[model samples]
Target: MIQTLKLHSLKWLCIALYLPFSLAAATLVGTPRGWRNIDWLDVFGEGGGALMVLAWTLLILGSRPAGTVSNLIFAGLGLIFVSLWQDNIDEFWIIPDAQLWDTWLENVPMPIGVVILTLGLIRWYQEQRILMAQLSKRERFRREHRSVDPVTRLASADYLEQQLDVELRAARRDQAPVSLLLLDVDGFDRINRRHGVAEGDRLLQALTDLLLLNLRDGDLMCRYGGDRFAIMLPHTNETMAVIMAGELTAAVSHFAYHTHYEGERVRLTASVGLALALSDSPRALMQRADHALADAKQKGAGSHASAA
Candidate 1:
């Protein structure tokens, strides 16, 4: 309480000094002469500056998305607001009459703020474009984090089924084609045995990155199970899925994986299965894909195979 009283006493002393200076200033000869009778102009102008400072601080601190363009826009507007407040405050105080420095103090920060805000915004746009490309598959998981897979950081099997269901209904209505591509590591059990489970986990992470790189923005990829991924292709036909499956096979077959502990290159392959909805429910569609993947596994042991 004593510290608070001391601070309050200091504040009162500052007010006492400033208040006398404020009262001594002669009123300006303006057409709206009645306006100078009250100190409302000074109060409002100072309030405005205080509010602008608050806004600018919030924008600068809160806009931390690494060059936030949206934040730049907000900050530029705040600068303009503060410049106007400074200009307004000058009307009440006529310190050393006819001084140009007061106007400069009011106006210079505006343009500088604009320049800084513009650069920040441009960088933000570039970063956003790059991010959109990198996490393109995550578009399907937008505004909803609950359905995302904790392990792979992609959408889960449940999300896949939900999306497939929605896309299937739309396809049936518009006569557009929608298909699913399932990919699983070939003999993942053996890899786990040879490299240990931790290494196997690293392989899965590598596999996830490779798959994400190969997929388009509209396509959805999910972790269906251990060392398995499912891709939902909207407005895609069986032939397109086949071609993509082939590409996935090629990408994984040639993927050069290095173990962190051993620094040894571990090669891995994936078996893929393609399934078209074909007027089936989401459950039935998944069953068909599962069976197709099983068929691909039985026929081939080391390479990517397709099911009938």
Candidate 2:
């Protein structure tokens, strides 16, 4: 948290400067109220409110990375804190009637702070909705956090099956087609042997990124254990699925990977098999794609095949 706060040091510096400046201005230009004249109740209320706002500002800065949302939120909160701090100072000092700036300080920031804060919250909500939509494609209804692959950063095979069942049901009801594609890296074990296992993991991560680039927004990809991946395509027929499979295989074959340790170039290739859903259970669909993948493997590396 301390390191994260350091990233936004400039914002924090602004708060630090404003705090002392507010205090000093009130003390220098305003007459200090005697102890009997001070309203302790207002002091407690206003000062406590300022402290609370300060704590909130620190939490927001420490938790979020420096960005538009962070900046807007910090700016808004900083303004609110300033307004409250000035209000609290009023309990100890009485500004001369001639000085209108103190009145401006007390009145200006509260409403403007609220408006800016509302805008920041709206933007933050929109961001969360987009993230949830993307996550839905990968995990579907059973959004178990553990159902994500640690190495590839894709959904796990179990998550793929769960989403496949949902898609299959929806396809059957709407009379729309769905497709499943199973892809496996060709001779992945040999790559792991030639290059270190760490390098092999990096290769898989890179390939995952490549495959994602070739897929549509609605397509779901998952890591089906080591060197194997599964994709679920909703509202797609066998023809489109086969074309997508070929594109993925071609992309993998053309990808150039270098070993992190030895700095040696590594050539990568993938084989893909596709099956269209037609009154088929999720297990049957998967089995068909798996068989098709075996057939593709027999054809040679970087080959794509489709099931009848």
Candidate 3:
């Protein structure tokens, strides 16, 4: 568990030692106030707050992966705990007027900790928004697990067809345009041959995450087949779909996929095809997209084509 926490135990130990050292320093420089003169209420309140903050820090370190946000939060909480601990110590000890370091220790860290904590919280909120978007994508297909692809955790080809039919009917009723994007991983077979099938599966999963991040709300993505993905864009015209397809292709080309074994970074590229929903049937629209995809592949890697 300590190893899994990625050296958080060392951080915790350091903080724990700091508290005692701070108390020892205060005792060394200051005289203990009489029992009647000590403010027991202030000590209890500040001490309790410090303990609570310490608990929260431990909870965060245990639950979250070690990253920038987690580190900021942990450091911020540790500083706050130190400030509170110093305050509690001050309640029971009387420092000389000449000693200014104790005052700095109690006052300086609180505001700095607050500022760091606020920044961490803002970053955490943004992270949660991205995670929520990803979760919503998976939640849509949760009810029909049989129609979800295991590798990418995306909807299957059958589910994509079903959603296409539904979206097409709604588009016709509203007189709005709908578009389809077909994306194919370029040289995926070569990747599989060079880096095992497990690595290939991981690459597909990473690609799925990238696609989800680029998509807007209400867009549906599905694993069409082995290395092909289909996206249904409601209310999107051919021009917008084509632009999105080009962006996705560029994003894939820039992505660096790493191998699990040798940790070697591999660059990947994709070909994308865009088709407007002119036909009433989902099968016809998919066929047009598929034909366009073949044309895109012929043009070479990272190419995009739009069907008329």
Q: Which candidate has the highest TM-score of all?
A: 2
lDDT of each: 0.71, 0.87, 0.86
Better of 1 and 3 by TM-score: 1
RMSD of each: 9.8, 4.4, 8.7
Instruction: Report the C-alpha lDDT of model 1 over 28-121, residue by residue, as the tens digit.
Output: 3222224555477665766577576655645444534322564565556556555665555555554443656556757886897778678767
The count of residue-pair clashes in candidate 1 stands at 0
**Which portions of model 2 miss their true places by more than 4 Å?**
1-4, 20-67, 85-104, 121-150, 279-284, 298-300, 305-308
Candidate 2, 140-245: lDDT as tens digits: 5556768778898788877787788888898999998899999999999999897778888999888888888888888888998899999999999877888899
Collision pairs in model 2: none
Which is better, 2 or 3, measured by TM-score? 2
Candidate 1 worst ten-residue window by lDDT: 24-33
Q: How close is candidate 3 to the true structure, as a TM-score?
A: 0.57
Q: Please count the clashing residue pairs in each candidate, in the order shown.
A: 0, 0, 0
Q: lDDT tens digits, residues 222-305, model 3?
A: 899999999889889877888899889989988888899999998889999888874479999999999999999999989999
